[model samples]
Target: MIPTNRLSSSRNSRKPVCSRAVSRRGLIVAGLMLGLLGAGSAGAYGLCPGEMENAGRMQQRILREWPLRSSSDPASRFIQQLGVFLAQYGDEGIPWRFSLVRNLAPNAFSIGAGNVFVTEGAITFAQSESELAAIIAHELGHELAGHFCADSYSRGEGDIFMPPSEHYEVGVGSIRQSIDPAKEQQADRIAVSLLQAAGYDPHAMLQVARRLPAGGEVHLHDPRRIHSLERLLAGYPPAGGLPDSLTFKEVRRVIMGETHQR
Candidate 1:
């Protein structure tokens, strides 16, 4: 973890990373290498605390126990870039490590402090970049909100995606439940704000809610979730923002083996 920098230059005047709009997303993706600077400055943002050594140690443990897939893959790098970009708006104290796992279940989770892991299935299932980014934003919301800082999870020290608790914080000796319903809603709300503020279409979250199947790891039920999300964005319907990327499509093609030859 290092110093942190502001995501936009000033709320009013944002400097796009590219001269051409088509490559703007690519530029943002590349700019993340230096995005983690300017620590202790986001007080108004309240992203994270100034120190996170404890959370850092836990992140190491999770990385050690679980085999992480290489992020060199374009699709994987895209996901990492999304997380890093969203993170730039959060606390700099958080290292914000992103990883792609081999699991088939469409799941995403964050643990310790700033570790966000997305499953291969999630990538394959997401129809567009916005839908995928919405999911990532939700998971990152969990980390930013300090849900993992719960006393039970802090010492439990078990794999987060397991039965009982399942996908994003299972219990150790005992079977503690998964993330609280209230917390899920809170994350959803926070995610919308984060996505919108980051120049992403907030309604993309609603699109994801419709695509997900019922049950395991799907919180708040789709219809209800959709209603709430729609209301939240009612005031701010989609306007110009980040668009679906060919990079995302190509990544999907490589992972899903679907030809874009047409």
Candidate 2:
């Protein structure tokens, strides 16, 4: 009888202990979530759990399938240099990579592991160096903030910044949809900051926004986004900075076929 009573007392004592443990765990999880929200607001990019482990492997696999334009090409080199300059402000110790794709669609995307890619059409579409930098900066922002990694898990695939084969009715009709509204805004904000830090006019982003064709190969027209960009640019009025250089002009001339060189 005494042993039975002792057993009951022991079980009762453990009940409060178990409850306390669960409560502590819940508080810890809540704290972590709050911290993540705070970081997001501060423009600090945080990867999802276990993302760092798989990002490299996934990036390598995707690069194999994606046709990469040769880095030795003059046009490709020009884009790469611009992307590298913008990427310098990203996370340290990360090996930043840039590639210019051969596709003519005005699209740019970033996979994980600091790998950023721009289509030839994007370069041809930009009116100025700042405009092109704006596009690259936006993709860099996506990579820095780990949006691509999060998107990959959500969609259960390697490439999250592109649409599926079925969605392709014509040339890159669905590529723009890969970036949802919230992520796009977040990336834009980050890109603007990066551009400003790199001595590029933030207003150049607005110019590109205005230039993008409505329902075109690149991003479709979003009035809300345009309004937001306008507001952001208003904060940074245009001042003289890095405008189109001779090198940039040469690259554009070659890309547009305005000059033919053997």
Highest TM-score against the true fold, candidate: 2
Model 1, 205-228: lDDT tens per residue? 877877777665434245656777
Give residue 157's lDDT in candidate 2 (0 to 100): 43
Model 2 score (lDDT)? 0.60
TM-scores of the candidates in the order shown:
0.68, 0.68
Which has the greatest lDDT? Answer: 2
> For all candidates, what are the clash counts?
7, 0
Cα displacement (Å) at residue 223, model 1: 4.5
RMSD of 1: 10.4
Deviation in angstroms for 145 in model 2? Answer: 2.2
